[model samples]
Target: MFGMADMDPTGGLWNWAASSSLSGERVQGALAGALERTVISLDAEGMDGAVLCDVYHVSGDFPTLIDVYLAPETIAETTAASAVAVRLEVEIILPDDSLNPTRYVLADPAGGLRHVHVDEVETDDGPERRHVRPCTGDDPACAAAPEDKAA
Candidate 1:
């Protein structure tokens, strides 16, 4: 488990764009269905592993549930402060039946996983969303001696 970061107002950079008029009941139902269907699909593919789930509902807006699977070995080290950095070698299954075979890192100050490439991704049933902050080793924030927070 990771330490929970205070809800950062800028965290929406990594969030799905949800409609503002959705009722709480509707949002809950959709989130439940998405979670069930996704988990089942992943299991059928023999890729069932530990999952990290995040459900966000900032203020009174609609909610979004984001899930990712990270293997134990991938988590390099975690600080007491709940800061974790990991290199994930995996394929991101998009709703459009496309796969992004990219190495991602979970370095969001708000504890979110993000693609290293900053690009718009089309999902199977939603508006395209952009991946935030593409950080490489050369990025000062990603280097050993950090100067300022990059992402």
Candidate 2:
């Protein structure tokens, strides 16, 4: 089950938790259902097309917190423009594990979903920087785009 803890014009955060006896597949289905419900609610409130920015387990426990970051997209040229930084996090978790957590799932305006992973690499300047890339075979629920699948 899940519940929304906070919400605002910019975004919202929700918490999801399931029983330990539940299978990983069931957990995934529940998570997807929660996301779908959230989208519907947001759309009803005129906040459609909000992008999911982060998902992480709370304190390495059962309840997971998901952060959805929303920003208005300009369909035409406007006076002011703003930028938002997106960071995706990736870590290994078994598919059969009941608490499977994903870093981020981006929902585009075209209704396309992109799963991405973020890695930190050490640069020449001796600083670690995050690099985001598409989800690989190891990731759970990772799938190719519709066009790619058709080809």
Q: Judged by TM-score, which candidate is best?
A: 2
> Which residue runs of candidate 2 sit more than 4 Å off their true CA positions?
1-12, 15-102, 120-129, 138-151
Clashing pairs in 1: none
Taking the tens digit of each residue's C-alpha lDDT, what string does model 2 give over 22-115?
A: 3333333333343443222222445346433334332222223333344223210010000011111112211111122333333322323344
Instruction: Give candidate 2's root-mean-square deviation (CA, Å).
Output: 16.5
Worst 10-residue lDDT window, candidate 2: 76-85
lDDT, candidate 2, residue 6?
20
Best candidate (score: lDDT): 1
Q: How high is each candidate's TM-score?
A: 0.21, 0.22
Off by over 4 Å in 1: 1-54, 59-131, 144-151
Model 1, position 57, has a per-residue lDDT of: 36
